[model samples]
Target chain A: MSVAMPPGSAFLPLSVSLRGARLVYDDLLLFDGLDLELVGGSLTCLLGPSGIGKSSLLRLLAGLAPRGMSGHLHDGSGQSLRHQVAYMAQQDLLLPWLSVLDNVLLGSRLRGEPPDRSRALDLLARVGLTEVAHSRPAALSGGMRQRAALARTLMEQRPLVLMDEPFSGLDALTRLRLQDLAAELLAGCTVLLVTHDPLEALRLGEHILVMNGRPATLSALPELPGAPPRDPGDPALQAAYRAILRQLDAGSR
Target chain B: MKARLWRALLTLAGLLLVWQGVVMLGDLPPYIMPDPLAVGVRLWRDAGLLLGHAAVTALEIVLGMLLGTVLGVLSALALGYSRRARRWLLPVLIASQAVPVFALAPLLVLWLGYGMGSKIAMAMLVIYFPVTANFYDGLRHTPGGWLDLARVMAPEGRRWAVLWHIAIPAALPAFGSGLRVAAAVAPIGAVLGEWVGASAGLGYLMLQANSRMQIDLLFAALLVLAVLAVGLYFLVDAGLRRLLPWHPANPATLENG
Candidate 1:
């Protein structure tokens, strides 16, 4: 799926159509009759409280969702999209024994290519970890480790990038920096990020899908303004945040 | 230097005092509990011959340990890195452990004869389980993010890349644990094999000394065996510390270490 980079904000031409999807785990129904659509090449931030199945939705979209879950998805231009989508889990699970560069080059290793060391190095440079390319994950701080994990994710070059709480453990400063970096990089890819922070949703998401309640069906898809790389502190950003918070509050009551 | 010497002397003195008290209190004959001085003198007198046999047993332990490492890693890789192999062989491997080493030792001796070969085989039987378990656990426990990163970075047939880049490296901790256990147990297997049926080793020496009522020589042989086990353990432990320098336990002194 070739995602045409949207001007001003990175947009991927996504027309993801899911109809009557259902997921269950050990007799506990996670969702049923779940229908959702993702706009092409758009930054969609999925937000919900814990146990709302937001992460589960991202897993379904990535086709890595667990067994016994069934769903159908269509790409942009009303075409059936069946391609390898990259998945980033909630934890920065870098192999502790490998250096930052080696970890990033692992994608190439798995596919049987002489790991393109230069490309891995460049991507690590992009994440500001060029000097520590030879450093093992155990030697890195939490933020650095997560950054290394992000670089490893980027090495895949997949069209669809799915992130589940990628910024959950970062401090405010590092989280903001990573959010901007993620937005800049995804300028050419389809990104479906599951997050809990409203401000993050406003700052990075072009479209926001709020999930809530039992079996956690899609609550709503609200539009955000100023187009990402939007200013995190812009008045328009605050306005979007305020709107999402109100909806969440109303839903909880 | 002085403090260490003082500590050493104190420890020696305490050990001797305890030995004398136990011997006296138990009303044991000299054959049952030789004085520490008598054992030391006997060990010094037999040092040359005892050292030669100790070297032979030590060689068997080392060779068997190396063999076990190769076998354990290869089997672990075959079982852990492949689904088909794991499905077919994993059960057999687990079931194989139920065959006790003592039960197998005689069979190995029967097959290999009463030589260094038999001793090495016995040691191999003892060393295999820990190494296999540790390596397998380590290989399987590679972080999910690392695998995902590998998929993204290489997206090509860098499967070996995952092996070198992730699997082996991730498995090092568990591998180290296994090696430590194997090192400690290697000498035991050698001694046991000697005990069963062997000549020119510490186990043989112990039996000969005991039959002759050479209690001092028996204690000396036992002492040498303890030293071999401890020395092998320390060497392996130091190597692990060197490899995993970043591990918290490596940087700081562990109570056991």
Candidate 2:
């Protein structure tokens, strides 16, 4: 069976391989000799207990690690992701002065490219924020703000997306809906989402990368080949969640 | 807004009544402190002369504010951009404030002469520190999360692009606070400079009235100066509110589904 993708959204799937990332902060080695490889065009949900350096890996992949980080991270094309990535930070980080529409178009504006207003508007509509497109970020609800942030991430039109707990603060229902939306919009693009919720990981991730230990280590759990995001109530998905938790439990020791 | 305005008017009226009572009960002569009515009458009768002097004082204060704001912004940008420069220059800028700026008034009048230049210089000096310090603090405190987002958006070695888009806008509210403080204190500089030496402005007029024993006009000039200071502050505050429309305190809008 073939996967159905969005109309006019054909993008080359990218695979990323990170080797020997040595990330240290103030004499504390957060990550050392950390090697990770991401499946091409797949959603990789990285789950870790607090402070396991999951975000450091994403920073390295996105070429945003601190200046002195010693590592080599290459994508499928063997090229730098320095200009090929989009990131959604934990905070919405929307420029407060700009309207919601302008915040989504910020990446293009910063690059001096004429804003693709039609595309931004389309993304805004898809995210269900059409009416408040002219509203300031301070005027948006928490869920709506994160949706706008999600739209901005998609607006970059980058092959790879790095998201750090993009929907952690949302209500449960809102988080579930956004998970579905993110999966739909980011179907063809490679994505690495950092999250703490196990059910969220089971719902969205095609491959579960469990992180543990200081100078963090990564271990991949077994996965079902069904397309995400699967039903959080699906028995198969729940079984997969149990397996992931077990793997995490074993890896901790 | 109406309630707030009424509250302020009530407060002013109550203060004036107490002052009038003090003058009447204490049997203080008008020479020591003119009654509020006398001051008001003097204000109305000398409105034309007061307006002219007010115009001059207003011009000096406005020019000083503009210069100080521009210089302070430039200095903030410089300090924001260069850590090395900040390490050396920031202390020097702070140290300059320790030397009583009032002490510089006579020297400014002697050097720049008894004109608008000296008064403007004093006002500029008074306003420079708050603007620079607040702006620099704002720049330094840009959220780390925003910087990370900026880095990913335009990691093209485009420092100016990052600063213009993210750093400046984020820092503006703090900078606007500095401007408000500057506006509140701006009149002091011009008036002080005039008191040291000047041919025009309300401060100069008040000094002349004091020596000539025209205490009523002196109090009138003081009243006019107070009105101007309060008015300037409100104007600046209103302008800043307009500039920062997204005050981070608006009622949250629902996400249209």
Candidate with the greatest DockQ versus the true structure? 2
Q: Against the true structure, what is model 1's DockQ?
A: 0.34
Model 2, A81-108: lDDT tens digits are 7777889877888888999999999988
Q: Compose the digit string of candidate 1's lDDT tens values, residues A83-106.
A: 446667768877665688977876
Q: How many residue pairs clash in each candidate?
A: 25, 0
Give the candidate number with the greatest TM-score: 2
Clashing pairs in 2: none
List runs of model 2 lying over 4 Å from the truth.
A1-10, B249-257
Over B102-190, each residue of candidate 2 has an lDDT whose tens digit, in order, gives: 99999999999998999999999999999999998899898888778877888885778778888898899899989999999889999
TM-score of every prediction relative to native: 0.85, 0.94
Q: Candidate 1: misplaced stretches above 4 Å?
A: A1-20, A77-84, A219-222, A229-236, A250-253, B1-17, B20-29, B81-96, B140-165, B246-257
